[model samples]
Target: MLKFSILKCLPVLAVCALLAACVGPQKQTAGYDYTAFKSAKPRSILVLPPLNETVDVNATNGMLSQMTMPLAESGYYVLPVAEVAETFRQNGISLPVEMQATSPKKLREIFGADAVLYTKVTQYGSVYRVVDSSTVVTATAKLVSLGTGDVLWQGGASANGKELGNVDFGSGSIIGMMVQAAVKQVAHSLADKSQEVAGLTSQRLLSAGQPNGLLYGPHSPKYGSD
Candidate 1:
């Protein structure tokens, strides 16, 4: 009888094992090749002004201000963004696209930077739903070798701000609720909460030692360890 009971439990145990395997974390691949990165060992990075692809015109500069700290904290010298912008303007390059389109060789000659970080802000704004409103920011960054123009590393991050709760209009008229929602939307817009979200996104993309993230730079204590 004991043997028969054990036999009966075999199927249940097998199912549990299968379910556990299905829920387990899958292995991750380090998507970038770091051969050139380690070989060059770049020490300074120039961050170009971000190209804004979203509807918000303020997204570009708002996101740009948040990038330098993370790169500097990750053990690289970041050129002063304001100075870079002024230089570009004096040279007749007024837009991010134009700056990015400038030849990599010319960039190396002009800035003496070891690498350049190009970024794009694809999403930045408050999105409204019936019950709540949330601000979302998404961005992608690529580190390119100034000497060779080869892409050394690429990563992206996205963040959403805490959702604002809807005003409860219990048993209110439809028109009244609509007006309330409109007012809430306007108030949220005035807050510009997306700027906060953009800061978090920039940090995640530029900080090192995260899984599939950037390798530690030469100045970091963990420099050669990554």
Candidate 2:
């Protein structure tokens, strides 16, 4: 009887394994084309204010402020963001849309940048459910050559509080779960949890060594290795 029962469960076990494989993360078979990015060989990068597509008012500056360090660590000279924003303001182009709209030729003329990085914040902030609250940040970026006006590279990244080890607010009782979620939401908002996630997202999006990420720039010791 035991042997028969084990043999009967084999098909069920195989079906469960098949279901798990179906829902697992898919791997990319085709890699990104790096022809344009490699040919550009840009050294100086100009990061523009990020265009915000979400309801969060802080998304633009939050994402923009987190971008520089990763690019610098990747071996590119990232122009100071504060000075860049001020320059836009002085030129009467205070809106991110306007800043992004400025022609590549004009940007090169003004900043002498070899490349420009334009970013859009698609999601930023906390979402509350009855038993859970999560803070997430998501953004996409494009690197364009100033001289040729060709997009050299493009990628996106997203991060969440739970991924950073944020504790879950779920509870045994429904009422307790709701209360914990509410408190967690309030704390997350007060602490600006999304901004912390943004920093991690920026690192993943802009770091050079990442798969299909920006290639190492001239200043890096491993330059030309990529």
Candidate 3:
């Protein structure tokens, strides 16, 4: 009986070993390569108006307006956006696509910036469902060296108003949920909550200090620490 019991335990141990082998050590994620970005070490960033891929006409301006604060906070000098837009307009380069297409050398000469940030708005505005509604904003950005025209860094971020924990319709009847969703949709549209969400997205996309985020600019207190 003792021998049989030991044999049974051996099989159980073998199964556990196999299971452990199957669940091996977690793979570490590869860190972003910042070689180019580190080499460039830009001091000033010129943000061009974001290209709007969405149907919302306000997406470009909304995303553009929110970009400056975060980049400035990251310790880089952000050229005044209003002035930049007007400069483009005066030169007959009113479209974001055209602005982005302008040669990096020309941009350096015109704006006297060390680098330029190009952005695109992929999603914006509120979407309505039968029992739920939410505002979402998504964007991607790239930093390029004005001198070399090499891409220094790139990242993307998104924000949803519902996920931000600000939306609440209460746990109520289905009819009540529908009504609340409708009312919330109308309120969100009127309030243009997508712009608010864009602010959050811009912070995530441009802010330094976070893992895989932009390197700190010279203006930041932690500039060299990164």
Candidate 4:
């Protein structure tokens, strides 16, 4: 009694399922230990506005928003944007009315974050269009120790946009929809990345026996095994 309409969404559903499968059960890193960071829970943390550096000016918001969801989902107390903004103001960093990116030092001073996460967009929009719709976006995120500037954790993710078969959706109104679809796709990947980062960061903190003040959830068991 299955209708064609039900069958029609099979690919979309299948892709969505596969996307999680691909990111989940991810390869766990080996020989990592943590003991230092868990002693003091990460009371408040801040994600600096990602550097756009992309062909698209709006790319920064996409990453920032995506990054927030995973961390918030994991249960850490996140610093409010307004507070971070105010901190920036007091520090003498003049952010444009529309700007929201956070600087490293400013993040430390404003949120008193034990660590700061910095992200740089390495690839965005499209560079070569002949083969596919320049719909793939990638970013490199690094967690730096506020005390030493040492990178505590690092991860990256790439999102694939909606495709109407072989035709690129990059030409019209569909572009906006495609961009949104891409963000959703990327959000899942970034969530996985966040899980992995949190897991690994936990291990690092636990191994060091130092309370680094941040904790990623155990949902990502791969972080512990690796």
lDDT of 2: 0.92
Q: How many backbone clashes does candidate 3 have?
A: 1
The residue-by-residue lDDT of candidate 3 on 1-226, one tens digit each, is 9999999899899999988876664322446778999999999999999999999999999899899999999999999988998899999988999999999999999999999999999999987888888898999999999989999999999998876666687868899999998998888898878888999999999999887899999988998898
Pick the lDDT winner. Answer: 2
Could you arrange the candidates by lDDT from highest to lowest? 2, 3, 1, 4
Model 3 weakest lDDT span, ten residues long: 22-31
Residues 47-116 of candidate 1: C-alpha lDDT, one tens digit per residue: 9999999999989998998998888888899999989999999999999999988887999998999999
Task: Put down candidate 2 lDDT per residue, 1-226, tens digits, no spaces.
Answer: 9999999999999999998787663433346778999999999999999999999999998888899999999999999988998888999989999999999999999999999999999999998887878898999999999999999999999998888888765557988888888888888999888888999999999999888899999999989998
Please identify model 1 stretches exceeding 4 Å from their true place: 1-31, 163-184
Worst 10 residues of 2 by lDDT: 22-31
Model 1 error, position 137 (Å): 0.7
Candidate 1 residue pairs in backbone clash: none
**Each prediction's whole-model lDDT (CA):** 0.84, 0.92, 0.91, 0.51
Residue runs of model 4 more than 4 Å from their true location after superposition: 1-43, 95-107, 126-128, 163-226
Positional deviation of 168 in candidate 2, in angstroms?
3.1
C-alpha RMSD for every candidate: 6.0, 9.0, 5.8, 17.6
Q: Which of the two, 3 or 4, has more TM-score?
A: 3
Quote each prediction's TM-score.
0.78, 0.84, 0.84, 0.50
Cα misplacement distance, residue 118 of candidate 1 (Å):
0.7
